[model samples]
Target: MAEMSYRTALVTGATSGLGRGLALWLARRGLRVFAAGRRVSQLQALAAEAQAAGATVEPVELDVTATDATLERIRALDGECGGLDLVVANAGVGGVTHAKRLQWERVKAIIDTNVTGAAATLSAVLPQMVERRRGHVVGVSSLAAFRGLAGHGAYSASKAFLATFMESLRVDLSGTGVRVTCIYPGFVKSELTEKNNFPMPFLMETEAAVDRMGNGILRGEGELYFPWQLALPSRLLKVVPNPLFDAAARRFR
Candidate 1:
């Protein structure tokens, strides 16, 4: 186990995928981890697995979409833990929302979970962190935030919103000892990505992707984009002419 600056951490969306992987990784590194998710079964499994590995991981049943409840639960958890050294707002939902056949329900879920839920998770911890002048907050965004993909309009937009939100927070909190990191990841194997029927380039396994993100969070990077293969092109797409970018994005449709 590597020496860590953080002694206690909370990871939202910890029932599966990157969130689960990150929670376990942090525990293994000697941090007391609070894994929050909606699935009781999965949370129990996570706690058991961590215990077997001789790590501390507590499961907290939370639905980030329930703003009031989420805020209350996390604040109480933070107080119980004495203070959260790190908080990862990794709870997010993804789906293909074609512009022509857009479903309001799907788009709303993406917004509620990815935007509202993530914001609530951070808000719940930030006040104390600010008062104490010590903490790290991470936001899991996506490379798709660089451009609005043809078939993933809403999902891409939500990520973009998160990235911008994190960036703003970083600037606002500078010199305050609160570190803000926004991670833009490419495709990683997860429940959310498994539903994609179209091709996913530069697909990454959950463990490897989470490892990279974990390192970045600990290093206190302001913005981390992984799998250079995809990150390079995605960064370029941000400046590509709209006419050219649209032509290429159409292939996903």
Candidate 2:
């Protein structure tokens, strides 16, 4: 693990849940934080709290889904913070849908926010990071990426893309100072998860998820899996044969 201190960190989806938790934790560590999200009120509250702790908290009232707006916010931040040391793309959504009867609208929204938005955000910042040859790109993917999941095809597939993308990035930047880490967290109790009707085997609190992510990032882990148990099982299901996976998932049904 490199023991370098970061002066600035940009966290997306920072209004509530895991994103908010990560922003707070980073701020308390004395890093200037640029929190981006659509919720102005909650961003304000987070800014105020983070400011009280001696961290320069700039709450960006920006929509990442808007390409121009995302670029503008990031460009302004480059000047405000001089340069970004770490970027965390944590925006995502969850909904249930079957392959045969997928909710195309929800799937579209998920692809837009989770995949396209992340790629756009990375595009906005990576050029500078590459120019400086110093930075970290951490994404909040999910263990769902390991499997197709029962009724959450869109969510799982989107996360799978992130997992693969980040891993490839890590390899591509091996010699460079820039590092890419993908976070595959298990069930966490948060707004994104409160709507789930099924039981989450190893559900953790947002703070726990925050700690897990931070530790993973600090350790320079190429990929992260929280609570440990949910990590390989999800991956193993895919390896075990389609018939076995179909049988296992039947329990959820």
Candidate 3:
């Protein structure tokens, strides 16, 4: 794969974790970055940190769940930046509740943010990428997408949707000079994973995870899964018989 050079980028969920890490990493690579998230203070803090590092980062308060507003902000940012070389759809939420305890509102929120919001993010940026004939789109999925965990049905299903969506999109954009990458990360230290009660095998630090993902994205890899220790098992689980898989996965619940 040829080395990909980026001049400008936007990363959603930039307040913390992988998104924040990617935003800073890209900015440090000499890309002007738009760090987007729901929290103004956190975004500002990220921008300040980037500036202190001699990088350019602009904080953009955005809620990916708000589709129209998010699109408007992206368009405005694109106009301001001349064009975007990359867009990372990384905002996500998850819950550890059992199906019986999973409220309707919670399910809706997960689907809306993870599925609908991701689609909206792509919809807003892809047209511009196609027009420019140069851009990369990164979808931050999860290993959970390979199978639906007992207590993480909504979250897993959402990631499944995203992985499939990005795959389909990659085909749709073939020969368009627009790269699409879907990343299925295993357990990584982050605000989201901090809530998990079960033992997380092959857990990686946020910085290491970001580095791996960044490298994959730069290479324009169609799909990426890290820490082979966890990724191999997740892929194996995809082929296991449902009954056996359920029995094994239930232990995690």
Candidate 4:
């Protein structure tokens, strides 16, 4: 494992699931964490748990979809926490949409939260990292980004946007001492996946997923796709013929 290079970390969506797991992992690694999310009570509980474990965790109430306010809060936290060395824009939402029953509001929410919110979180932190010339920015995308799934078109498209955005940021920040990592996790156990009734291939538990993600960040990997059992297939899917891919994807529908 790479030695800890970051002293302070900021994690969004820390109230639950992967975000919560990442926050706790960072705290355990002895980094002071600013955990942000919309749920204040859960954040407080997380803070308490971390403190009990002899780690520092400060709960910051935030809703990433509110771009302006979210940016302001991140800036405030950067100053208050003695500047952030790492930022993970892990806040995201998922929805199942059918062509016949697709609600504009639901589709919009997914796009706003996944695409816009992810961009806002990164925008809020990148300026400071650029000025300081040292930091890591991570975006938790998904394996689903490889294709636009029938029932989750908006979600997959949002992730595809996010994956490309992270790549673009990496290109922009080259030689600037600021690193960007995109993690594409497949079928990890989380609140989002807990609702799914379909079979999840190579399903991984939360702790294992968190461990892999932490390792990736520490190693400063450009792009990390976990549980290669799924990632490899997803990568191949990108090159598959549209007709063949459509036939295979229909099983999940």
**Model 2, 124-215: lDDT tens per residue?**
88878888878888988998998888889889989998888888888888877888999988999899899999888988988888988887
What residue runs in model 2 are displaced by over 4 Å at the alpha carbon? none
Provide the lDDT at 12 for model 1. Answer: 94
Which regions in candidate 1 have their CA more than 4 angstroms from the true location? 1-4
What is the C-alpha local distance difference test score of each model?
Answer: 0.92, 0.85, 0.91, 0.92
lDDT of 3 at 187: 93
Each model's TM-score?
0.97, 0.95, 0.97, 0.97
Scored against the true structure, residue 14 in model 2 reaches a CA lDDT of 94
Q: Give one digit per residue, the lDDT tens place, for model 4 in 1-253.
A: 2333789999999999999999999999999999999999999999999999999999999999999999999988888877899999999999887777888998999988899999999999798899998889999999999998888888999999999999999999988889899999999989999998778899999999999999889999999998999999999999999999999888767
What is the C-alpha local distance difference test score of candidate 1? Answer: 0.92
Least well predicted 10-residue stretch by lDDT in candidate 4: 1-10
lDDT of 1 by residue, 1-253 (tens): 1223899999999999999999999999999999999998999999999999999999999999999999999899889988999999999998879888889999999999999999999999899999998999899999999999887888999999999999999999988888999999999999989988888888999999999998888887889998999999999999999989888877656
* Reference-based lDDT, residue 1, model 3: 41
Clashes of each: 0, 0, 0, 0
Worst 10 residues of 3 by lDDT: 1-10
